[model samples]
Target: MTQTLALVGAAGGAGTTRLAVEIGATLTRTGRDVAVVDAAYETQGLADYVDTIEADVTELVTDGAPLDSVVQPAALETPGQLSLCPARAPFERLARAKTAGAAETLEKQIAAIALSHDVVIVDTPPVATNQAVAAVDMADRIVAVTPDSERGADALARLSGRVRDVGESIDAVVANFADGTPQVADADTRVPATETTAPSQCPSCLDDETAFAPAVAAAVEAALDTTVELDFETSGRLDGLLR
Candidate 1:
């Protein structure tokens, strides 16, 4: 069975894109057929991880093209392994499509992509929007990416409530930019915690080794085993939360 995971944030700038890239890359390295789709119409940063094709889910609703044609392979160091489908256009285009049923059409487009891959990692926009809600509603597992700060935790709490309203649950919470400091302990939430360190001074925000690669691998292993191991150097600090 194909497993689908949506990485969502309480609000923007919560590192959902980074987490999705790292996790997807890791899965690719482990010999899995991984497909990463950027569902967020506002930001397609996840496309930077690989050779990306600009696509709008709404196009599937109107054009009737098969989803496989719309997917673009990521241009990461690991080639021929990871695939990416980027959201280059706006969701407003989909909302405006004069299809018989817009929402159902959009859902079918997403389903087509999910059916083709062994693992589908979606980087969703904030939970406050209708598009994000649609992605989460269709996801089998949702990972809420938040920071280890009071405001970030509060945002997760609010998002958690919203997810519950739709009868969905957050499978985990990833703490981004978690320097190995006391601040890491601030995010006290129930979901399993995956802490990532701040990558060196680079344009893209993530550590080199532990950034996207390790996290993606860990998430994949965890999903298969029904438990994500949080023992890597960057993730080790979060062991307490896992226990």
Candidate 2:
């Protein structure tokens, strides 16, 4: 069976969506089919990674759209497929998608996509809505992504407590845009800041030169409990780099 992983943010603007796309790209490097599902309805950042989203996660859960039909392939040319189920809808539809009944539909849609993909990765926001709760509760493994700061560490603690309330615990933690986070020094993966790109372009992780790719590969490994053969210092600290 395909294992589901939820990469949830500890706070707002934690770079969760970018990290999710990089993780999916890294997994695809190993010939693994990945489905990048979006539960961050508020941000809809997953929409940036793809060219366009005709049918999306919001429609899947709210209007009962066919899950497979909505899963558009990410604009990547890797050996393995990187499909994205994004949320690019109006506020009214988004509101409806966040309802409890729609959350249940989201949970089922996740399982439905898992059948076709080797790994299902949900890009989740902070657990504030019913949809976020559904994603976290349905995931086989959860990885918390936080900024590398004192505030981020505090938020991570809160996220942990919230997960526990729902009978789940974070399997790992990733500190994005790390710049000497003494507060969260023990984060499972420390991702350095890299150059930003347009949402319509390919992910930077596809490049073999940058440290960003290998670091994200490390995060993917830790989050999914799999090995990624990349040449980067995942065990050391690379501070002062922009994410």
Candidate 3:
């Protein structure tokens, strides 16, 4: 069965999309059919990251566009390749993307995409959005990405509760742009917290050598209690360092 994983940003600039791209890239290197879906209709960063604006998830859900028609391959296709379904419309159209039955519509669409891909990594908007609620609802696994700050911690706490109220739980929480400072919360021991490397200045820059992908893959493996082979250098065109 295809694994549907959603990476949600607990706070703004949490590097959620970047992590999704890296994880998708890593999975592709392991020979898994991976498709990263941008559910964050407002930002639409995944389209630019993959260098393709051909079609987006908006088309899939609103226009009833076929999966193949919406999914476009990443710019660099080597060592296995990652596909992306981005948002075609701008932020204002997000309301239109939210279907009448909201969660149900998005879930069905996401499930259809899952049928064709081995792994579907969803990059969701902030926790407050309806798109995020649907993404979390449809995902087989949920990974929260946040900065190592009080704001991120508080946002995560609320987001976790929101999902739990809907009968779901966060599988793991990744602390992006972490500086090893003591701002993370220990409210729950069951939920695992991990850290990812971030540049001193630009936290959004994508770096293949960073521990981001490995950390996320590790968190997923630990949460799911299964090993997922991830090679780190997939983006650099270098041989993958298996973990």
Candidate 4:
């Protein structure tokens, strides 16, 4: 069975996108065909790490376009063997892509992609938007990305309620931008927290140690008990090291 995983943020700067890339890359390294779908149209930096082709999923929904035509292969600097569907250009394309019959259209496209791959990893936008909500509805497993800060925890609380309302469950909570230690409340019991080094310099601390791909691989192994095989050029390089 193909696994469809959605990585969402408890709030912005949760490192959800980074986690998605790691998971996709690891899966691909293991000789599994993996596709990374970027749903966060606004900021699409995730496409840069891998070979990315522009896919207008919204266009597929609105115009009944072919899903294959809409998907573009991302460009990976190194050969990691992963495919990517970049978020639409101009961002608004996603909102416009949601046609009256968009739900079914999007699902069909995703199903087709799933058939061609062992795993599909979706990097979703922040939880409040309808697009983000739609992605969650389509996911087999949802992973929430949070931080160790108090505000981050609060955001997770609110996001958790939203997930419950949608009748979905979060498979894990990745503590992005973690410092010495992360403090998660007892009430948030859906998933345990995984921590990595915090990103530095970047405004969102997006490039911190938490952004490391291997750390994410470890988290996935812990969460799913799925062994991963990676091609490592070096211990720390995120790009060459594929599972």
Each prediction's RMSD over C-alphas, in Å, is 5.2, 2.7, 6.1, 6.6
Candidate 4 lDDT by residue in tens digits, 174-226: 66554344465422212222453232211211222433445556556643446
lDDT for each of the candidates?
Answer: 0.60, 0.85, 0.67, 0.61
In terms of lDDT, which candidate is stronger, 1 or 3?
Answer: 3
Per-residue lDDT tens digits for candidate 3, residues 31-102, read 777888888877877766644465578767766777787888764454666788877685555667865564
Colliding residue pairs in candidate 1? 22-212, 23-216, 50-74, 50-75, 51-74, 51-75, 199-207
Off by over 4 Å in 3: 77-79, 186-213, 219-225, 230-243
RMSD to the native, candidate 4? Answer: 6.6
Best by TM-score: 2
Q: Which candidate, 1 or 2, would have the higher TM-score against the true structure?
A: 2
Candidate number of the best lDDT: 2
Local accuracy of candidate 1 as per-residue lDDT tens digits, 1-243? 878887887777776766665666666544556677766766656545444354544565556656766677655554225667665545666445433365456556667776667778777877665667777888888877777567677887888898998788877666554544423343422223344334222122123343443444444544333444333556564443332
Candidate 2, residues 77-171, lDDT tens digits: the string is 78789999889989999999999999999898899899899999999998888988999999999999999899889999999999898888999
* Model 4's TM-score against the true structure: 0.73
- Checking candidate 3 for backbone clashes, the offending pairs are 56-86
lDDT of 3: 0.67
